[model samples]
Target: MNQDSKNKERHQGRSFTNETLFLKDLVGFQRIKYRYVNVLGMLAGLLIVVQAWALSNLFAGLVSFNTLSFFMLILGLLAWLLRSVLHLIRDLIASEASRNIRFNLRKKLLSELTFLGPKRSVIDEDAALSTRVYEQVDALDDYYSRYKPQTFMVTVVPFIILLTVLPISLITFFIFLLTAPLVIFFMVLVGHKAANANRKQFSVLAMLSNQFMDMNQGLSELRRLSRVKDARERLSSSAKAYQSTSMGVLRLAFLSTATLELFASLSIAMVALYLGLGLLEKLPWQLGSSPVTLTNAFFLLLLAPEFYLPLRQLGQDYHAKQKAEAAASGILQILEASTSDSSTTQVHLKDSETPQTLMLFDSLSLDANKRTRLVSISGHIHEGERIWLSGESGVGKSSLLYILLGFEDSYRGQCLIDGIDIKQADLSQWRSRLAWIPQSPEWINGTIRQNLTLGLSNLDSASIHDALEKSKANIFIKKLPNGLDTKLSELGTGLSGGQMQRLSIARALLSNADVWLLDEPCASLDQETAEAVLETINRVSEQKTLLVVSHDTHPIEWVDKHWKLTKEGLYEVA
Candidate 1:
């Protein structure tokens, strides 16, 4: 894309101020890690000047064949060793702090996503969340552990060096003062532009990730439709876009580094030229007495590079700061979202006590896109009621299911369990009284027993066997070599539609919950499998309050109440 187009895409309502605040909140002011790192860095800075002084004096003594040359050389080496050890220890401490910070930040982000739930959160794209949680948060590692501490040294270390040099040569000190601010001014200017570029780069990365995830998820569909080439082209386009954006960011980072290097080199050269001229007593103009000794000249030259070292380090980590800030933008959006009402009363329901009345009074819900799905809806189901709710695909059947699951609260009215608004009841307590079997049941790469029990420690083998038998899964499961111990692939890859459906039913039965919410239990199954699943539902409904959503209108023996949802409203049907 052209610069203008890229800039427009990047400026899509992003507030740099808000992003800055997000980063500040993430790092915070009272960081104990920062404090420790700063103290060690300042001590290291002090030792740096000491080592420089020793080395300069050693050089002068050696030139004069002085006896103290060896002692000065030893002192320099010792100071150098101590400085190296301190830096190593400081880095270790900073690394540990970075690890802890990343861990805590990821945990906090995940908690926010959980509180937002799938309904409120953007969950369709797996890569979006992964990029924010992993890559974006990781970018902060250098900023916290390296860049930030170096930033402090950039300010304090140079001043300390200036103090040491002032008594030896005021001219060298004045030259240092004049050139240092120019490097900073250029670095700050370049760094500001680099931050914007980095933000754009991270945004592109997220887009690329989402695109790749979509391509992966829909590859089968694309191949079946003979549109794989189209999909590939789209993915390639996204990849190219990301590459271009990344190159732009890298170019800016390189430019900033080069700028800092150029200014630092020039500045050091200027100081060196002045010191050399003064030592030779060859300056065209004189401001003060030339107190330039070989030792003083060497000391000033040695400290010049040290003065610019932190600024160079800061420039190197400048991009890291920008990337972290960009990542913080996404993280903070989730963190700052208004949480759902967590108000809950002491009212609790027994696991096996089938709800006497589950009612929705004037309840409504809007989908994630903020489109009205259900409007002024009202309904009731009594204990032991077998209800089948049907609707056209977009008529809000799933929205209602989400509401009853306590996953969506974009609705306006009330949902009550036994006359108490479920909103007022402890959601965890209320959810425990129910079991849900989605159209696509999830399974881990484990044995059938693990999938069925789902880590419920209290569920014994006898109970599992009984549940499986009731769901008709026991017959097929027993034939396997290890029966319940038979391992399956992710999503139960070896199982047929009928087997997976039966497994879901078995899991629900094992819960022994008062109510069962089955969403399209017979979907995508062959006629025989569908009949078997319907039969399992028929058997389960007799003992529990069953709410099923199915497109198949063919009457079933188990259904005691029937309802249809529409854009107008929800109502009972014949």
Candidate 2:
């Protein structure tokens, strides 16, 4: 079988104890907050018992034509009010705890993605990560706010009611004792199936989310290829599959609830039958007399359903537990995988120290998907030198830039900066001294000013205008109605390809990094615009290092040296 199937089988086979342990570990300090919620639940349970007792006594007094005790009436009302207040407080605490936990988990997930950088895409699809961060994390809400505390309530509340019932009548107590296990039995029996269905539902949801995201992202391409129909059919199939799994989960949930209700109703009926016969003084056995008094019989009858209430609620929350387990599997997969990988050391470069030489030795190679991309390559580039790197498509030119950016760590041999292996240095600190411009620059839906100054601060207006003019983007900015304040849609919509590229160059110029890695920087520009941008780049980077990767030969004219990458290795074309 394939790896995904194997993983699914393993996840399904995981024991309940193991799944609970995983969820508890995620709860972290939030577990302490649950302790307080549980205490409130216990208090609520006691109040429920008190309220039931007082009401039973008052009702028996009325039936017997005795004067009602105003004190018992007052006591019952107070208990009910206090119980409601406790429930409100408990819910508030649990909701806050759930919110905080989700927030912290999302934060950790984001940090992991940031640390993984470009390599994160290799591990999982963006759509899958997005689903985990938003929907799957949300699935834990019911688990924390309801199911977790109900677990304790199911044990404590029922036991308290049983204590109240046992002293009143042994027959009622035995009935409670015998029938309670049946409800729990069927709950567990149906719960196993529900858990499996929930996991399948989560799996289908992630698949559906990924498929939809892919279709949305590539909708333009699909239209161009006249394959939109095919894409739609596939998406429809995934949606249908998701619907099937979701219905299966709901059916099981209803089945579990019905099973619990059937058992609980029968148990309550059995208690009522015993209490009615005893109250009528119609004992079936040769016992001296009916031990059940009117007050006692009424109290036992009142408390019977309350005894099973926690168990019934627990049966309902069992589904939430299943959902949380499924969601936690996805969440823990990302968290645990990040921890298992070998991480870069925390060695930081001195602020006063700048890399003067970059060296590669000992047959540096990069392999991806079991195919060699870079083979036995050795090279060096000194500071303040503009090198033009030329290679055909699929020759690992972009991969080399990825390695220097600390985004690819699977490369063999050493990439050193001024005698320090780049792998050993803190990547954030290392990347701070370098700027990268990819073929297609990324932008958010915001004003042009925000896009330009992203992750930067304390820039004066003069500096911003200077970078804009140097990159020749100021010419277009002047024509726009809002200038730099112009709001662009996602991916810099409303801007031409050349305009977007110029903005990227202008942003890089503002960074003032010592090393600049440009991949097809002028690919989107016309010949005239390309030369203007390249000229600005050459002038600005004269004192810094430049490693420009291009398929075209035009950029070679102004470079200090030229490097060609072939299947064998990288070679200097002097």
Q: Which candidate should be chosen as best, given lDDT against the real structure? A: 2
Q: Give Cα distance to truth, residue 131, candidate 1, Å.
A: 3.6
Indicate the residue-level lDDT of 195 in model 1. 81
lDDT of 2 by residue, 196-250 (tens): 8988887888888889888887788899999999999999999999999999999
TM-score of 2: 0.85
Instruction: Write candidate 1's Cα lDDT for 1-574 as tens digits.
Output: 4333432432332343576655555564338877888898999999999999999998888776765677788889999999899899889888887888888788876755654454534443557777888888898888778877788889999999989988887888888889888887888788888788877877788888988877775677799999999988988998898899888888988998999999999989998998888877778786454558888888889999999999888888877887777777776665544224433345664333545666545555564556777766887888878899887887878778777876766567787776776565556667777888888776778888888887366987789888988889988987898988999865575678889999888888887787899888877787777887898779765867888987754445568888887788888887
Model 1 is weakest, by summed lDDT over 10 consecutive residues, at 6-15
Off by over 4 Å in 1: 1-19, 24-30, 64-68, 109-117, 120-124, 166-171, 192-247, 287-291, 333-338, 342-355, 367-370, 418-424, 479-482, 552-557
The lDDT values for all models are 0.77, 0.82
Clashing pairs in 1: none
How many clashing pairs per prediction, in order? Answer: 0, 0
TM-score of each: 0.85, 0.85
